[model samples]
Target: MRAYHLDAPRLDALRLVDVPQPRPGMGEVLVRLRAASLNYVDLAVATGAFPAALPLIPVADGAGEVMEIGPGVSGLTEGERVIPHFLPDWSAGPLPPLASRRMRGITMPGSLAECAVVPAAGLVPIPSHLSFAEAATLPIAATTAWRAVRTGAVRPGSTVLLLGTGGVSLFALQFAKASGARVIITSSSDAKLDRARALGADETINYAAVPDWDRQVLELTGGAGADLVVETGGAKTFARSLNAAAAEGTVFVIGFLSGGDLEASLFPIILKMLRVIGSNTGSVADLREAVRAIDATGLRPVVDRVHDFADATGAYETLSRGGHFGKIAITLEHGHRAQL
Candidate 1:
């Protein structure tokens, strides 16, 4: 099978190579990958900012059919459509690193290959409504959004503020709307804000033009501020999120997509009693709930681009561009089931 590997620092390290196909080891399942999706992690892995990573295959979350199961594996069947949980451990309710050595697309070989051997426990059923492209993006982005909203504890009609219209924020928008909360999305670009509004965002801020978006958020929410802020912008926006949040509201710390480095006063968090919580990718339960929500509402992933598996490098570069509004999918050949 041909797989993409990051040889060293530069993304020029990405190259196609033929390698032996893998078989499920003990407690593992061999999946014939149908599709894989890109994330900031993928870009980090490729460019080598991601440390403790072995020189290995790239691309994390994906969807495929179960082709073979290893000894002791059960409750999984052949030909079942499945997605690997973002974190193999912490299966039930919360997020935790599963084992000392297992995290797909990171500590281990991932699904960028034509086939992959994953722990049987990682696979979850893909909903009937989604295509391979849509299912591929779910385990990471969707689950992060799920965890963010859950941590926010927002009820119906509560205000939710999201930074950037990236994949996670878009998923957050959909889930927030489904829960009947009003979404306030911020983007530097008006065109992106327009698209966010179409997705049911009650308010939009061009944060590029208005740097102190928190004040704008305050004015928009009638001075109480947002009930939650999906703070992906990290240091650059953290202080602002603190300023923008409603008293006692939660701000889920998910990313530093804004390139990090911000200055802020500690008074707001001290006086308002706000919570700043960090969320890794969520649990299997969160993924399942997100899947059920998508199935129930027929809300599919918003895919901004699709590239053939061979062009995976170019696809990774697009994600760094920050222009994509949603998930980027890469299609792979079937390694298990025969196509007619």
Candidate 2:
């Protein structure tokens, strides 16, 4: 089988190479991956920002067909379409302490390969309405958004403030709207904000134009602020996120795209009586719930671009460039042309 391996902590180290196809072990299933999606963590691992074992497969989320089922795996059969959870060990409930360290693309074989042997328990059925490229975006981004919104207790008349138009934020926007919450999303580009408004965002802020976007959030809510703030920006925007949340609201931290170092005062959180919770993507069960929600609502993931498997590096480069509105995907099957 063919796969991309990051032999070192550099984007240039990702190279395509031939490897023997792996077989399913006990309680595992062999899947012929059709598509995979890129995430910021994949870029971190490729560039040494997030340390990982060298010379490993290099993408976290993917969808494919079950080709072979291992012994003791009875519920799933060959030919079933499924997605492998990014965190294979955390099946349900609160996250286990050690599960985050053993994740796809970082510690184990990931979706870059033509085929992978994933534990059966870690796989979730793809929603009937989505394509492989769309389902490939669900394991991490969608699940994290689902966890954040659910944790924040988003409901009708609630207000959600999303930091950007990235995968998690977009998923949160769709989910929040489905739950009848008013959403306010931010971006540096007006065009992206327009697209977000089309996605049901009640309001949009061009953060570059309005540098004091937290104040803008407060103004938008008539001084009450947003009921939930999905904080994707770490050091650069964490303090502002605290300012943007409503009193006693939740600040769901999912990413550090702007760098993770923090030097902000904790006064806002203390004064507002806010809850600051950090997310580690989500569990297989969360992925299952996310998929069910997508299925139930007929919600489709927003895929910005799709690259051929031979040009997989290009997909990573596009993600690194940072202008994409949503998830970037790569098709692993031959001649499987995907619409961007």
Candidate 3:
């Protein structure tokens, strides 16, 4: 099987190499990966921002068909379309201990390969309306957004504030809208803000133009502030996120695109009685609910571009450049599957 490996903690260390295809262990399933989507974590691992065991496949989100099931795995069958959970050991409830250390594309073998062995329990059925490329974006970004919105209790007449037009923010926009909440999204580029408005954002702010964007959120909400703020920007934007939340509102922190160290005040959280929840993507069960919501709402994930498997490195470059409005994917050619 062909796979991309990072022999060291550097982007240049990532190389394509032919290696033996992995096989399913007991209670696992071997999936012939058809498509994968790039996330910031993928870039971080490649660039040494995130630590990982060197010389392993790297990519967190992927979708494919089950080719074989291992012993003790009974619910799944061959040829079923599936998306592997980023955290294979976390099926439901609270996150398990040491789960973060074993995430796909970070500590273990990821989706940047022709085939991957995933625990059968960690596989969720893809929504009937989505293709492999679309489902590939759900494992991390979509599930995180889903968990954020759910934790915030967004519903009719609620107001949602999303920080940027990244994958998680856009998915939050879609999910919040489908729940009948009004969405206000911010972006550095006006063009991206316009695109977000077309996707059901009730208000859009060019943060580059308005340096005090949190004030804009407050003004848009008639001084009450947003009911939910999905905070993707850390350090630089965390203070503003705290100020932009309604009293008793939730600030769901999911990313650290701007650096993780915080120099922000806690007065807003204390005075407003705000709920600041930190989310690590989500569990396999959460992914299942997210897929169900997508199916129920007929929602589609925003895929910015799809690269051929051979150009997998190019996909990483696109994500690193930071202009993409949504998920960037890689599609594998399964022409040789018959030979397997």
The candidate scoring highest on TM-score is 2
Determine which window of 10 residues in candidate 3 has minimal summed lDDT. 331-340
lDDT of 2 by residue, 1-340 (tens): 8999889999888899999999898999999999999999999999999988788998999999999999989899789999999998888887778745578898899999999999999999998778899999999999999999899999999999999999999999999999999999999999999999999999999999999999999999999999999999999999999999999999999999989999888888899999999999988888888888999999999999999999998998999999999999999878576553
lDDT of 2 at 193: 96
lDDT of 1 by residue, 1-340 (tens): 8887766756888788999998888898999889888988788877767663657887789988998889999899899999987566657754454455367888787768888888777778999988888899899999999888888887798899999988899999999999999999999889989988988999999988999999999999889999899998888889899999999988888887666566788798889899988877877788888888888998888888888787788788888776988888888863332121
Q: Rank the candidate models, highest TM-score first.
A: 2, 3, 1
Model 1 TM-score relative to the real fold: 0.94
TM-score of every model?
Answer: 0.94, 0.98, 0.97
Report the candidate with higher lDDT, 1 versus 3.
Answer: 3
Candidate 1 vs candidate 3: which has greater TM-score? 3
* Deviation (Å) of 177 in candidate 3: 0.5
- Candidate 2: clashing pairs of residues: none
Q: Score candidate 2 by TM-score against the native.
A: 0.98
When summed lDDT is taken over every stretch of 10 residues in candidate 2, the lowest stretch is: 331-340
Provide the overall lDDT of each model, using Cα atoms, as 2-decimal numbers.
0.84, 0.93, 0.91
Screening candidate 1 with a backbone cut-off below 3 angstroms (N, C-alpha, C), the clashing residue pairs are 89-98
